[model samples]
Target: MEITNLETLPGKQIIAHFGLVSGSTVRAKHFGKDFLAGLKNIVGGELKSYTDLLNEARDEAINRMLNQAKSKGANAVINVRFSTSSVAQGASEIYCYGTAVKVS
Candidate 1:
């Protein structure tokens, strides 16, 4: 399916609007990674562990969003957006949302 942050797809015409669709997931850092992050903080470098975690979360959220769009019989999703928030001490939420539409 085609997904874009813009209101409309570049070459496709939006024929039907199915309103809003969304997906989200929550994840927490592993203890080992937490310890590594602490050490990295002292040395001041990239946190690869956390980066990987967020990347995986983003993919999962996008897959879920696509599943929702497909279930709605939509060929595309427009105005796609992502949101991240801390829901707990070590856990964060990843959310993806968009307007489901049929394109032709």
Candidate 2:
């Protein structure tokens, strides 16, 4: 399925809109990784562990959202959006959402 963050895709007309679809994944930081992150915090550098984890979560959520659209016979997903939240002290959730639609 094609996914776009824009309201519409260029060179194509939306023939029908299905409905809102969403997917989410939650991850927790490992204690070992947390200690490394804490050390990195002192130097104010990128937290590679969290970065990789979040990227994976984002992709997983998007994949699930796309699967949902496919199950509904949608050819594309429009106005895609991603969000992140901390559900617990060490856990974070990544969500992907969009409007399922048919396009030509």
Candidate 3:
């Protein structure tokens, strides 16, 4: 499925609105990574662990959102957005949402 953060696709027209579709995942910090991250913080540089975690979360969320759009017979998803929130002391929720639409 095509997904864009814009309200509309560049060349396609929205033929039908399939309503909202969303996907979410909650991820917790790995114990080993947390320890490494603390050490990295002391060194004052990029935290690769957190970066990888968020990247994975984003991809998972997108995959789920696309699956939902496909299930709804949507050719595309417009106005796509991502949100994150703390679900627990070490876990975070990643959500992907968009308006599913049939396009031509």
Candidate 4:
């Protein structure tokens, strides 16, 4: 399904609004990755491990949100937004939300 951060899709018209749909997941850094990230911190470089982990989490959250929208018979999701917060010392929660809409 098409997803956008804009309130409405450019060329599509919203035919129905299905309120809100959301998905969230919490992920923790792997021990091995954490150890490597610590070493990288000393060199003051990008932490590729953590970056990959977060990217994966974001994709998972988006996929879940899309699934929910699809279940509601939505063809697209508008006003999509993402949020991230620390759930614990080494864990973080990723959330995605949007308005499910049937567009034509």
Ranking by TM-score: 4, 1, 3, 2
Which segments of candidate 1 are over 4 A away from where they belong? Answer: none
TM-score for each candidate, following the candidate numbering: 0.96, 0.93, 0.94, 0.97
Q: Tell me the spans in candidate 2 whose CA falls farther than 4 Å from its real position.
A: none
Q: What is the C-alpha local distance difference test score of each model?
A: 0.93, 0.92, 0.91, 0.93
User: What is candidate 1's lDDT per residue for 16-101, written digit by digit as tens?
Assistant: 99999999999999899889988999989789999999999999999999999999999999999999999998788999999999
What would the per-residue lDDT of candidate 3 be over residues 5-103, giving only the tens digit for each residue? 999998998999999999999988879999998888878989888888989989999989999999999999999988999988868899999999999
Enumerate residue pairs that collide in model 3: none
The root-mean-square deviation over C-alpha atoms between each candidate and the true structure, in angstroms, is: 0.8, 1.1, 0.9, 0.7
- Please provide, for model 4 over 7-84, each residue's C-alpha lDDT reduced to its tens digit, 9 standing for 90 to 100: 999998899999999999999997988988888888987888888889999999999999999999999999999999
Which one wins by TM-score: 1 or 4? 4
Q: Stretches of candidate 3 above 4 Å error?
A: none
lDDT string, candidate 2, 1-104, tens digits:
78899999778999999999999999988899999998999999789999998988899999899999999999999999888999998789999899999998
**Regions of model 4 farther than 4 Å from truth:** none
Candidate 2 TM-score to native: 0.93
Which scores greater on TM-score, model 1 or model 3?
Answer: 1
